[model samples]
Target: GIKGQSLPDHYEIDSSKAKKDLGITFIPLKKTMEDLIVQLADLQTMLEQS
Candidate 1:
């Protein structure tokens, strides 16, 4: 029971393997975060202009 320990090693998820094994294509975290930030900024700008 290791608490607060993320995967101890930097393991790159093999996309092909993921699709074959898990049937899911993982989205990179950085890209997801960037998209969220951009959406939030756009929403804030719209709110301010309204």
Candidate 2:
């Protein structure tokens, strides 16, 4: 999907059996964004240092 005025999109992801058997869980979006922000900030710092 594009940034703005995007068309509807979808993907095929099935871990249903795994979820049932292995009890896997998903991370929250807020935590994902926080981790991504930290990673990007670290990359930016490395670029500046270089």
Candidate 3:
């Protein structure tokens, strides 16, 4: 069976199951950019505090 959404971070999948069931995984470019932006902001705040 196919999954409608990606597995949560805490969940683990068997290697064999992943190889057979999940062909490919993709994250949206916008989400990736947003994550990077948040990370950069965190880093900037850390630098300012130091």
Candidate 4:
């Protein structure tokens, strides 16, 4: 799992409009997970090299 600042206890998104209008894009979970794994691997490799 990843950790970082979270949203406010009371948060909401107006789904009435298209997400793009709100400046948000839809990314599939599998793609996101794969990208995150690659990023972590790259970071780890850089750390080990240094």
Which prediction has the highest TM-score against the true structure?
2
Q: Which candidate is the best by lDDT?
A: 2
Model 1 / residue 17 / CA error / Å: 8.7
Least lDDT summed over 10 consecutive residues: which range in candidate 4?
A: 15-24
- Badly placed stretches (over 4 Å) of model 1 are 1-18
The residue pairs in collision within model 3 are none
lDDT of 3 at 25: 59
Q: Which has the better TM-score: candidate 1, or candidate 3?
A: 1
Instruction: Report residue 24 deviation for candidate 3 (angstroms).
Output: 2.5
Candidate 3 scores a C-alpha RMSD against the true structure in Å of 11.3
Order the numbered candidates by TM-score, best leading: 2, 4, 1, 3
Which model, 3 or 4, shows the larger lDDT?
Answer: 4
lDDT for position 48 in model 4: 100
TM-score of each: 0.55, 0.59, 0.53, 0.55
Predictions in order: lDDT: 0.87, 0.91, 0.83, 0.85
Q: What is candidate 4's lDDT per residue for 2-33, written digit by digit as tens?
A: 48867679968675467757766778999999
Using alpha carbons, what is the TM-score of model 2?
0.59
Model 1 residue 36 CA deviation in Å: 0.5
Please report the TM-score between candidate 4 and the true structure.
Answer: 0.55
